[model samples]
Target: MNAQYKSCIEAVYRCIEACNVCYHACLKEEHMSNMSKCIELDRECAEICTLALHSMQRSSTFAIQILSLCAEICDACGTECKSHNHQHCQDCAQACFRCAEECRKLIS
Candidate 1:
């Protein structure tokens, strides 16, 4: 793959890993009862990131569309994560924002 494509794939993979970590971390929080929305978004974002990674890695014909949706999800996830005060959530939000930017680049 070209360097640019490789970089995008790497970004997607990193986002996937970050989302997975954040999801598990959120699940373990004692205040889980109040974090239902975050938990749900985390899981959904993780799944979308994984799918986006795979689609980009394979250079699927629909990769652009997938990445677009991933970008949207990442944006939403980042916004949601940033609303929390937890360190993990903050980190995840940053990662998600970065991922969204990377995905947007791919779109253009």
Candidate 2:
């Protein structure tokens, strides 16, 4: 992979980890009802990031398209996580935003 792809892959992996962590943490929150959006977004973000990583790894023709979608999902997840006060949420948000940026770089 090229240096750009290498960085994007790293960011995608980190985003996946963060999203997974946030998903579990949100489930454990006392007000589970309030964390529903965060949980949903976290799961979506992780799934998309995983797909993006795989597509990029294989150098698929649709890799750029997948990255575009992944960036959108990451942004949504980041926004949701940022609205929460938990440290896990904050960390996930940061990772999501960074991943989105990296994905955008690959697409553009």
Query: What tens digits encode model 2's per-residue C-alpha lDDT throughout 1-108?
Result: 545589999999999999999999999999999999999999999999999999988888899999999999999999999999999999999999999999999888
Indicate the TM-score of model 1.
0.92
Least lDDT summed over 10 consecutive residues: which range in candidate 1? 1-10
Reference-based lDDT, residue 95, model 1: 86
- Among these predictions, the greatest TM-score belongs to 2
Model 2 residue 45 CA deviation (Å) reads 0.6
Q: What shift in Å separates residue 8 of candidate 1 from its native position after superposition?
A: 1.7
Write one digit per residue (lDDT tens) for candidate 1, span 1-108: 445677777777777777788888889999988777878888888898888887867778898899899999999999999998988888889888999999999899
Q: lDDT scores for all predictions?
A: 0.85, 0.95
User: Which candidate tops lDDT?
Assistant: 2
Report the CA-based lDDT of candidate 2 relative to the real structure: 0.95
